[model samples]
Target: MNKVSQILVGGALGLSILTAASAADPKPQDTVDYRKSVYTIIGWNFAPIGAMMKGEVPFDAAAVVRHAQYVEMMSKAAPEGFTKGSGPDAVKDTEAKPEIWTNWDKFEAKMNDFQQEAAKLTEVAKGGNEGAIKAQFGKTAETCKACHKAFRKD
Candidate 1:
């Protein structure tokens, strides 16, 4: 084939590959697992901060900031894991409620709030202000509670 024809054919082939890859959805369980895994990581990272705040553990400012940064990063990622077919009906074992899929807009708004609060916590942690960090961290934790209250199934 001529150069122009070869280039056109190559472009078309690449587009087809990209389209097929995008169209292949993840398994329902995979989606559920992903969201759960993200939450698990967030929890693991958050525990240290909670301990520091409660005085159960020695206050490690650097550790608190690191954990806060991790939570902030993961909060941004958590929403994408709750894809279609990740709901309780599609997965036999999950804590997600049907309302997550049914009332997606509200659920998404809660996720956004979580992300915002997490960001605030990261900012406060960076400032080395224990009081402000504690206050903002409490607010961020409350954001998690709010979402759990609305969406989590026990």
Candidate 2:
């Protein structure tokens, strides 16, 4: 083939491979694991912040802001983790309820609530005011509980 034709063919082949890879469905276990990891990241950051807010531990301003930021970042990616086949019925041992799929609009609204509240909490934490962070922290935590109450199971 001529040089231009060869370039076009190579680019088309690369594009096809990329498209196929992106379109391939994830395995059920992989979906479960990914969703778990995303939640774990949120929980890991949230624990210390909750402790600080509740005075169960001495309030560390830096840690509060740090962890809040982590939650905010992870929250942005949280929804995508709940892919089409990642619901409870798709896999064993998942705490996510089938209601998440059935009541998807409600479930999604709750998820968005967390995203917004987490963002607010992130801003509050950055301000480093214990009072504001404490108040917003409660709001943020409530969002989690709301979603859990509706979607998550024991």
Clashes of each: 0, 0
Candidate 2, poorest ten consecutive residues by summed lDDT:
14-23
lDDT of 2: 0.83
- State in Å the error of residue 121, model 1: 0.6
lDDT of 2 by residue, 1-154 (tens): 4323533553545673333322366666666776788889999999998888788999888898899999999889877778778776778879989888888999999999999999999899989999999899999989999999888896
lDDT (CA) for every model shown? 0.85, 0.83
Cα lDDT, model 2, residue 41: 93
What's the true lDDT of residue 61 in model 1? 80
List TM-scores for all candidates, in order. 0.83, 0.81
lDDT of 1: 0.85
